[model samples]
Every structure is written in C-alpha cells, then in structure tokens.
Target: MSIAGQIAASCQRAIGITLARMMSRRQFGQTLFEHQALRLRMADLQARVDLLRYALHGIAEQGRLELRTAAAVKVTAARLGEEVISECMHIFGGAGYLVDETTLGKWWRDMKLARVGGGTDEVLWELVAAGMTPDHDGYAAVVGASKA
Candidate 1:
C-alpha cells in the first residue's frame, strides 16, 4: 500500500509538471490548466493523494494493523493510483498513450500492474470481508477440519 501511495504521488507530480508545460504553450487562447474544470479535477486528485498519505501515516503511527485494515488500505491505494494515472493521461491528451511521447504511458502501465500484482483488488476485498465476519474463526476451523 505504501508503494502504491508512492507511485500515486509520483504520478501526480508528473501530471503537475505536464500541466505546467501545457499552460506555458497557451493552447486555444488559454492554458488547459487555467480552465476551471481542469482546476477542479486537479484539486480532487490532490485531495485523493493527500488522503492516501494520511491513511498510510495513521497506519504507521499505530505500529500495527489488522488484515482487514491493511487490505482496505491496499485496495484504496491501488484504486487511487489507477485514478491518478488515468486523469494524468487525460490531461496529456492523445500523447499520453504513446510511450515515446510521454512518461504518463509508462505510469499508466505500472498502475495497471499494481492493481493485479499482489492478491488483486477483488481478492483483497474478499480477505477483508472474511476477516470482518464474526464467525471467521469457526469458518476457518470448519474448512480446516474438512481438509483433514
């Protein structure tokens, strides 16, 4: 999860840099970053990045976390990374899709891999659910006994 958060932060910084470059060119009589819509989107993305950072910090401060909490963090971080990269790509226009044109393409690929590289978002969700269940121990015991 920390890794995912770090990746997201890096992607956000890259997007900021790209937006700054675009703003300098004065596309269509105004910079894309100067538009209210883009500004709002960027704000939202920043909030998400901050939220992920906060979550990570809180977990670290606690010195320990349950499986469900860890899973939740992982899921949130992975999703945030995906969202950040996608938005960055949108800001980059068609050039975002070309690896030779922009690093956003590589970031996008890395985010996709992050989503599936671990236990996967779906598997993590299931782990969270199983851990949250009140009968988790009993259920595990039943399954274990059956395996014997």
Candidate 2:
C-alpha cells in the first residue's frame, strides 16, 4: 500500500480502538454527551460501527492496505461521519453546517478525503472479497480445479 493508504489504515485501527472503549458506556446520553464526536459515534452507533470496524481490521491484516483499505475503512467511518456529524448538522438546522467548531461543516468538506483516498470503493470490495481469478487461476488450482 502507499503512504496514504498506510495512514488511512492506521486511522481505521485507531477508530476501532476508540470504539471498543466506547462500548463500555452505561447510557446513551452519557455516551453521546460525555464523549467527543469520534467517541460518540462508537458508543451510540454500536452495530454498524462494530461490523465495519471488524471488517476494516481484517482487511488491514491482509497487509498492503491500499485505497481499497481506505474504502473499507470508509464503510464504517462514513457511516459514523454521517450519523454523528451530519446529525449534529441537522440538529443545528443549518447553523452547525456553517460552523467549523462543531466540525459538521469541516467533516462535510473533509469527507471526500475518506471516500476516495487510499483506495476507491470498488477496490475495497475486491480486496474484501478476494476478487477475480488470475489468468493463471492460481487459487482455483490450489483447491483442485484443473491445473493451469
């Protein structure tokens, strides 16, 4: 993976770590208000966040975290971004969208980085599913398909 992919994958890992921390919360209000946006997304968002977090970690372990890896990370990260920041933006009803301190506006601007950087979304799907047989068909042959 490229340097940007490496950083993106690392950020994914960091987000997972933070999510694990958030799961310990006893109440939704505490999770949302007590924690920062990053932490709130983890605690309140639970199911989807956990699924993508685990998936991103799995993809990172494959090594060479590329744009694909970034895409995979974005699957979870984007959901969280949509929920936490976008919700805040909605709550503000236009005001938050304009304010950088709330970070909804910043996230709205910065979202492109996560969406396309490292790897595009298509690349991530291929990476996650181990897409395509080579012309030589190495994996198929290993499992007892006719030898190439």
Candidate lDDT values, in order: 0.79, 0.51
Q: Write the per-residue lDDT of candidate 2 for residues 9-103, one digit (tens) a residue.
A: 43344345334434544355565235577455445545554555576567668876554445546554653544544544543345456655444
Each candidate structure's TM-score, on Cα atoms with residue i matched to residue i, is 0.80, 0.41
Query: Candidate 1, residue 128: CA error in Å?
Result: 1.9
lDDT of 1 by residue, 11-75 (tens): 66766866776577566789887888887887888888887778788888899988888788887
Task: Give candidate 2 misplaced runs (Cα > 4 Å).
Answer: 1-71, 131-148
> In model 1, what is the error at residue 31, expressed in angstroms?
0.9
Error of 2 at 54 (Å): 7.0
